[model samples]
Target chain A: MEKTQIEELVAKYNEGVADPKEIKWIEQLIESGEIDLTQLRELSGLDEQIQKMEVLSPSLNLDDRFYAALANEEKQIKKGTSFSMPSLSFLLPRLAMAAALILSGFGVGYFLQSPAQKSEVSELSQEVNDLKEMMMLSLLEKESATQRLKAVSLTSEMSQASEKVTNALFVALNQDDNVNVRLAALEALKPYVGKSSVRMKLIESIEAQYSPLVQIALAELMVSIHEKKSVNALRQLLENESMPKEVKTKISESIDVLI
Target chain B: MEALSDNALMMKVKEDDLGKMSLLFDRYKRPLYGFFYGLNKEQELSEDLVQNTFLRILKYRHLFHGEGDFRAWMFHIARNVNNDHHRKKRVKATEDLDNWQERIGHHENQSNEMQHNEEHNMLSMAMDRLPEDKREVLLLSKFEEKKYSEIGEVLGCTEGAVKVKVFRALQELKVIYKQLEKSH
Candidate 1:
């Protein structure tokens, strides 16, 4: 059909006088995009009214339900991404099997031990501690604060820490970028504070510390250990221009107590 | 910070930044609710369907490749949610229409605003008289703002087919509305 003929059909439909065949032709025209639904005056008016109709806004109850669902989903996501312990029912059998294996291994080792094997066992234990210390030191060098914290915590599992381990802890305490890791390093070093070398390093660490948290902790540690040598270092810290007044007061109080 | 585009937010949601889903929810909840409420005319059921639509969005978030329009993808899920609801209930669309006047009365009693507008009340009755498919097409047209192509994406049809659906729906609605006006 020509454009004028299609226009006539649309006009007929809009006038509400179109026969069925003309309405069918109008439908074809609408489908073909030659005529829009908006061209039909009555239908367009109805569509406009439908569009103008106002919907009631959902109540706060919907918000409550949606946010509750969202929060629940977020919890599920977190649980999926983070480590979570298995159910005790699921873990019981596995735990029993692991315990049996460890006990049998220990039994076999104990029965097989002679004086020569005993010395070799000591050597093996030393080598294991060495490996742990190496792993800890390497982890301490990691960029992640969590990894560094894990490294600091690893020292607590060692029955005897070598000088290398102590030196690594000192390095972490003095230079680690994370405050929590530094605090963990300080806690790890506390067990060895009775050593003259460790005490001197602890005193030395006081002046290098800038964080009031670490400075206060160190002052409290010095006061706890009765390390009077820390007074001069603490005094030097008080002299440092950038020291927080509270830390300076804390250090002064420690110095007076030590004197 | 600039607001992320819908696809960008959805992409983040797919990547497990699930918090971004809240942004998408806040944006679409009302429109989705309108679409569902337009279909069911029951406030609580419509709200439930809207919630179900979002839950499906989160569950199948991985399927959203961010290449298509987010709104279209959302309506696709919403259409399915509405269908699943009716399918599960086995409630006939005609039955809902049979109860349309009762539902309208209930709505009018619940909301004085609906009572104030006789034309919209008549239009709502006309919409309820439509078959589920026709009512759905009109609701999609209204909520989707006559973006027939996106409506097509939701309906799994072409743009022309969607336009024809809207045309037919409007034609029926006009007839029903006229009858309603004459009766009143």
Candidate 2:
């Protein structure tokens, strides 16, 4: 066979569509020294080499990011830009779980608080709540920012917040480096603002916050909650020479409303 | 029982069972990552492209006709997403393949591992120089193991065209790889 014929045969052989006759011809050529088998072998090995290349894994949060994105899209689908209370259908299952946990806690509390045991039922109940709070705090301390956000969001699912949960939120608000996590902590703390301690913390956080967005958000929250005590904090914030004009204005107006 | 196919899972996604997307994601993320990683060799950007691909999949889930191969449709979307990213960062995306070693050199330990795989490294650099279309065709066919029919669907060409492309791409790749090998 000529060189052109050998090249044609090699191409066919590499394409994996060579006939038995063509295969025989290639074998005959290799025997007769018309074509180098090594070259043809290398040509055929390209695909196999590519396949042998290692597959790369994306970061660990790929799934978490996907689910978070999916949930976000689903929420947008179910409720446009409008404000709608979380539907009872959605809340029922979570509510039932919380209720079941509380009932079981009560049962254990009752069993442990008999006459011989001499432990107060309230103390046992408080201990259960404390355990739940400890779990929340531990979750918040996770390395993943998503886990910390999840921990903050879980506070809203609790039947009620303990002092520890509220304190954890305050700590997250003032210290979390990620703006989104801190913002999530703020949103989670919204329902608890009626508490005097929460109100005091929100007022005090005004001075501690470095993020203009969080400071503005805290000021607005304090004003909305009608915490008269925040007037001093707002006034003190107004005294900071480097305060942005926009936030300073917001604080002054909030102070006017409070006074 | 056999698990649900990609098309079936995607059909479920189209019908508002969005949770089924997780199943689809689990099945396809690695392949998608492989495709993007092959294109740019940047892990973070590749991961971002994968995310953008899935997000587009959801955003345009309504457009799925439930007719063709779902994986093909996905790669089609992925190609579009990558093209969009390229257009947005065309100037910055022109980094040469030689920089790959320097980029990965930051880890220090992987330097030894990379030296041990010189052929793989050279092959990758050679692959990086192929025209994007040929490169993608080769990747989808050789790496992802898609059939000519699926590659055609993804590339919007005929199976015959894809077959011709695969042959031509392999020939071109061999020529390029030899040059790179000699230079190395």
TM-score of 2: 0.48
Candidate 2 positional error at B77, Å: 0.4
Tell me the tens digit of each residue's lDDT in model 1 across A29-72. Answer: 77889898888888888899889988667888988998898899
The sequence of per-residue lDDT tens digits that candidate 2 reaches over residues A121-145 is 5567667767767778999999889
Error of 2 at B124 (Å): 1.9
Model 2 interface DockQ: 0.21
Interface Cα RMSD for all candidates?
A: 1.0, 7.7
lDDT of 2 by residue, B1-184 (tens): 9999888888889987888998988888999998987776667678899999999999889899889989889999999999999886655536565666655564464435344534468877778789888888888985447477888898888776676566567767988999988987
How accurate locally, in lDDT, is each candidate?
Answer: 0.88, 0.80
Residue A200 of candidate 1: its Cα lDDT? 97
Error of 1 at B15 (Å): 0.5
Q: What is the total number of backbone clashes in candidate 1? A: 0
Candidate 2 wrongly placed segments (more than 4 Å): A1-41, A80-259, B91-120
Error of 2 at B123 (Å): 2.1
Question: Which portions of model 1 miss their true places by more than 4 Å?
Answer: A84-259, B91-120
